[model samples]
Target chain A: MNRYLRQLKEGILDQNPTLVQLLGMCPTLATTTSLENAFGMGMAATAVLICSNVFISLLRKFIPRQVRIAAYIVIVSGFVTAVELLMRAYLYPLYQALGLFIPLIVVNCIILARAEAFASKNKVLPSAMDGLSMGLGFTFALCILGTVRELLGSGSLLGYRVLPESYPDMVVFLLPPGAFLTLGFVIAAVQKLRGMSEERRRRRSAAPADTAAGATAPVAADGAHSAGEADGAGRKED
Target chain B: MNPNQPQPASMPELLTVSPSPHARRGVTTSRLMIDVLIALAPAAVWGVAAFGPRAALVLLLSVASALLAEFLAEKLLRRPVTLRDGSAAVTGLLLGMNLSADVPLYIPVVGAVFAIAVVKQLFGGIGRNVMNPALAARVFLMLAWTGGMTRFSAPFAYLSSGVDAVASATPLASLKGGMLPDASLADLFLGRCAGCIGEVSVLLLLAGGVYLLVRRVISWQIPVSFLGTVALLTFVFPQGGADRLSFMAASLCSGGLVLGAVFMATDYVTSPVTGAGRLIYGCGCGLLVVFIRYFGGYPEGVSFAILIMNALVWYLDMLTRPRVYGKTRGRRGDRKGGGQA
Candidate 1:
């Protein structure tokens, strides 16, 4: 259970395929013009990710090592076709919204990356878990980009008007350049947050050792208390 | 000047140690930026007089926001604040000039912020930015709100009916339709027309350009080659079946061609450093302007043309590199004995 939770955390935050690893940029930039389209694309890609992962793990032994990449593509395309048809039958609106991207999911590096890196070596249950977590990570990133684009681009959220009627819509946010701009800023913010957290962790780990060093330094300095104060200041600067 | 002759202890306080090439000059970034601001003053004043108080408001807001954004960005980035240099002021003023005076109050503010923060500072500020910050912001705003950016009120309409006046068509729009604008050649030359705030007055912009040229603040290669190319193309082609001379004059005088050629394209940081490269860059801009104006969706193409050429500046510089003395024509990579030098 603990191992599964750690894997989930790693997928969503530490090694996010879209934000951190930066895979599948084509659909992330293209279909994220609105929340509904982004969500639909995310869910569809996630579904394909899971199916392909499990099936690839099952066929791992049978597939020759030399031809594994070709075999992975064939498996991924098959699962993508299944997801596309299933969405067409039940989620027609979403199906129409994410037109070319549905078929293009077979080329998404995240699914293939997991299959090659994890699923091929892992058991079925673990492979399924990896797929579920990575897919959710992709979905989370898409939804974030989508909400920002839709809210600013259309002055609404999830097809509902949140801003007042008089609010001037920044139409650029709906365009291609806006997608690149939004993604760049989002990545910058994520990196900054990660850096801050890592800094805090480092400081916490170093605190006791630092105090012990300071205590020893003052004792070695004998009665010169100002020397310890100066040493502390130097350390602070460092 | 001998190092052994040093006497006073205060000398160390005055002199600083540095690398070779010990020559010194009084020229500074702030001085050059201030010179640009001085050169642009006449056109800005003419724009305000021709348009009205609202035009003044746009210029004021743009300059203020640019300064504020620059200050905030530098502070946030933990760099030494360089607001006194006046580059941001120039960017703000140029951005204001590029915009129609009739744009909403927030438009200039937004554009100024984007120009300073994103285009200017984020790319390592001042000399390091790849594109002209004002031109990039203008394009961004134009793409964002096509309707708002295109709407132009007739000159002095604000004096009569105020800011809510109907959008008067610009000469570029008329030329785009393959017909001459209603304004006489004299009116267009003298700045009695509907257009962007600073761009309506060709005479004033030229005056500013001439001032920059006289001060040796800018080289003549860019503006000369740029304007010469546009003049040659439009004269030979003669859009709208209008008389060649008049059409050529109108095309040169109308739109942001003069404004862009004089001020924006000649921007020091974005244009090529080599003289030959500047000429090619200018001609490229001129060709693109005519091409896009003739064929593109937008009626005016000055900003887009200049921007597209701006992106190619590094390549142009490399292509036009001067030969090193006693070396072959090709680059170091192509020569076997190049590394020894």
Candidate 2:
């Protein structure tokens, strides 16, 4: 149980597919123009990822090493086809909205990467957990981007009017160039946040050592270390 | 005498030392721009003659506003002002040519601001802009002030008689709105119609285009392929064909095709760089122009088509990349020598 939880944490937070690994950008940019579309795409990709990961893990022994890639793709496409048909029957509106993107799941690098790197070697249960976590992380990132774009682009979110009537819609936010600009800024923000946390970790690690060393040196060493840590934190924050 | 004077520094020593290819010919940016300006004079004169002095007024206003906006934006951004590059002037002239003389003077002012300040400078200016500044400004103004842009009443001062200047639709607009009047091929070619100031005279625009070609300021691939595609498509599927000649002439002369295929679509900043890429870009622009004209809401689609092709220029360049000097063409996997073993 502890091992599975660790695996899940690694997939979602420590190594998020979208934010950390930066995989599967085509669907991320294309279908994330709206929150509803993002949700539909995220759920569809998650379902396919989870099913393919589990099945590929289970059949790892039977698949030939030479043809494993081809085999994995065949397995992924089967699951994707099943999800595509289910969406068509049950969620017709979302099905129409997503259109060709649903089939494009077959080409999504994240799914194939997970299958080749993790699922092919891991146990079925752990593989399934990894799939679930990574899919959820991707979904979260998509939702954040979609919410921003839809709100700014059309002054609405999930069909609800959030912005005031006086606000002029920035129509360009929904255009193709907007996708590149927003994604670039988002990546830069994530990098900045990571840098901040790394600095905090360094300071926290140094604080106890400084206090321990202060007993020997009295007061000067303590002041020096504290100032050093503060300066490091300041640089990171800037 | 110089050789005797100093034992005399040999000819090589007397000459200023520089890197290999020490010989150079003069082709400065300013000189290139001056050439373009000279080449554009015939068309400008033709436009003034066709539309009266208002054409000249619009052109001057657009140029002045573009320069002012570029200067102000650069001053605010603390970047060196680049008006001397002559790109802003070119953008201003193109913007003026795209607009009708009767358009409110403030419209061109707004367009100049959008063209220079927003589209060009904000995107890192001149060569760095991804799309054509003039076309982007035209599209921006068209969307922001659609009514003001679409109303093409004759210039008030240009009225020869005491005739009430009618708000006549351009030929493209007329075709799209299903209200095309009986117009001859001669009128379309000779600038006897209501259209954007410079777009009326196909003959004069062609003269400028030919001069541009002769000067090698632009390559022929883009214009030839673009115009050829539109002509072929229209010949095959013209809606109103009284005869082949009328159909071909109408398709060729009507709308902003002359302006677009000759000047706008051929814009250096927005177009592809390679020979094959330009051909593909031109064909794509042509197809989109015809598609939008026949099926879409807009009467004319030259601006939209050029903008769309501008967005695709990167992809087209990628597709048509010239092969490396000594590399052999091979399939993706095969390039790794997978089948050789």
Candidate 3:
């Protein structure tokens, strides 16, 4: 259970496939024009990622090392075709909206990366968990990007108007350049938050040493050490 | 950074101690900004007078929002406040000039903020921005609000009639359709046409360009090459069987060609550093302007053209790099083999 939770944390926040690892950029940038499309793309990609991961893990021993990549592509495409047909049959609107990107998911880097990196090496259950966690991470990033793009680009979210009628829609947010701009900013903010958390973690770890030194050592020495650490933090940012 | 260094005394004599040959020109970022502002003053005043009080309001809002954005961004980023340098003011004014005067007041404010905070500061502040801020903001605004950006009111329509004067098609729109605009060549040249606030007045813009040229604030290579290429292309292949001279004149005077050539393309931070590179960059801008004007969806291509060229400035500089003092023209490998041979 603890290992599963750690995997969840790593996928969602620490090593987000889209925002952190920067995988599957094509779908992230192209389908994120609206929350509906983004959610659809994310879910579809997630479905493919899980199915491929499990199947690849099952067939890991049979697949030769030289033909592993070719076999992985075949497996990923099978799952992608299944997801595409499923969406087409049930979620026709989303199927039409995502268009070419749904089929392109067969080539999404995250799925292939996980299939080769985790699924081929791990057992079926663990491989499935890895896929679920990574899929959730991709979904999280796409949803955030989609929410921002939709709210600004169309003045709505998930097919509902969120802003006032008079609000001017920034049409650029619906365009390709807007996608790149929003992604760049989202990544920057993620990095900033990660840095802040790391800094806090460092300070927290250093606090016990400071208290311990204060009890026996001189106050000036502790102050100097902290000051030096603060300077180092500032330099790290630069 | 050196916290242990001894603090310097407050005495003026000690502060003045420095390297010899201490004489310095009064030039600074602020000084150059002021020069640009002064050169731009004539066209800005003309725009206001021609477009009326609403034009003044747009310009005022743009300038104010730019300054506010700059101050707020600097404070938020915890950088030293350098508002006194006036670069923000110049960016604001130029952005205002690029906009149609009748746009909703919020348009200029949004443009100014985006110009300063996003395009300029977020990219690492003055002298570090990749593209011209005002132009980028103008493009952003245009893309965001195509209807508002495209709507142009006739010159002095507000002064003679109500503020709700009907919008007119710009000359570039007519030119795009291969028909001469309603305004004559003289009217187009003298700023009597319906267009963006600062771009309509070719005569005044040229005067300002001349002023900058004389002040040595800008070199002539860019504006000359840019305008020259446009004139040559339009003259050689006059659109719609129009007279060569007339078409060339109209192309040179219409839309933002003069304004962008004189000011935006010549932006120091984005343009090439060397003369030859500037010429290539200028020609590239002109060629793109004509290309887009002729073939693109948008009738006016000044903003897009200059921006496309701005991205190529580094390559242009590299391509036109001055030769090393003693090096041969060919590659080092070829040179070594040739010397041995």
Instruction: Give the number of the best model, judged by DockQ.
Output: 3
Docking class of 1: acceptable
Candidate 2 lDDT by residue in tens digits, A1-238: 8987887777766687886798998988888888898888999999999999999999999999999999999999999999999999999999998999999999899999999999999999989998998888788878877888888777899979899996656565677655654665566456555555655665666567856553444244444544443343223211
* Candidate 2 CAPRI level: incorrect
Whole-model lDDT, model 1: 0.87
Worst 10 residues of 3 chain B by lDDT: B332-341
Q: Native contact fraction of candidate 3?
A: 0.41
**What would the per-residue lDDT of candidate 1 be over residues A1-238, giving only the tens digit for each residue?**
8988888888889899998898989999999999989989988889888888999999999999999999999999999999999999999998998998999999999999999999999988889889989998999999999999999889999899999998889999899988988887787667666655655565566556767565444333332333332232222201
Score candidate 3 by lDDT.
0.89
- Candidate number achieving the greatest lDDT relative to the actual structure: 3
**Model 3 spans with C-alpha error above 4 angstroms:** A210-238, B2-24, B329-341
If both were scored by lDDT, which would come out higher, candidate 1 or candidate 3? Answer: 3
lDDT score, candidate 2, position A80: 92
How should the candidates be ordered by lDDT, best one leading?
3, 1, 2
Q: Candidate 2: where is the Cα deviation over 4 Å? A: A1-22, A47-96, A99-107, A123-129, A162-238, B1-26, B34-81, B99-133, B136-168, B175-198, B201-239, B265-341
Task: Encode model 1's per-residue lDDT on B1-341: one tens digit a residue.
Answer: 22433457664566687898688777788888888888888888988998889899999999999999999999886678989988999999999999998898989999999999888887777897888999999999997888788889888887775456657999999999988888888889888889999998899889989998998888999999999999999999988788999988889989999899989999999999999999999999999999998999989999999999999999998898877667676756437545533
Query: What does candidate 2's lDDT look like per residue over B1-341, in tens digits?
Result: 12222364455656676788766667656666666666666766777776777678988899899999999988875578888978788888889888887777777887898799767775666676778888988887776556667776542335667654577767777566543434577887877777887787888888888988888888999999999989888778766534555565687898789888988888888899999999999999999998998898888899999999999998998777776545554455346544422
CA RMSD, predictions in order: 7.2, 11.2, 4.9
True contacts kept of each: 0.45, 0.00, 0.41
What does the i-RMS of model 2 come to? 16.2
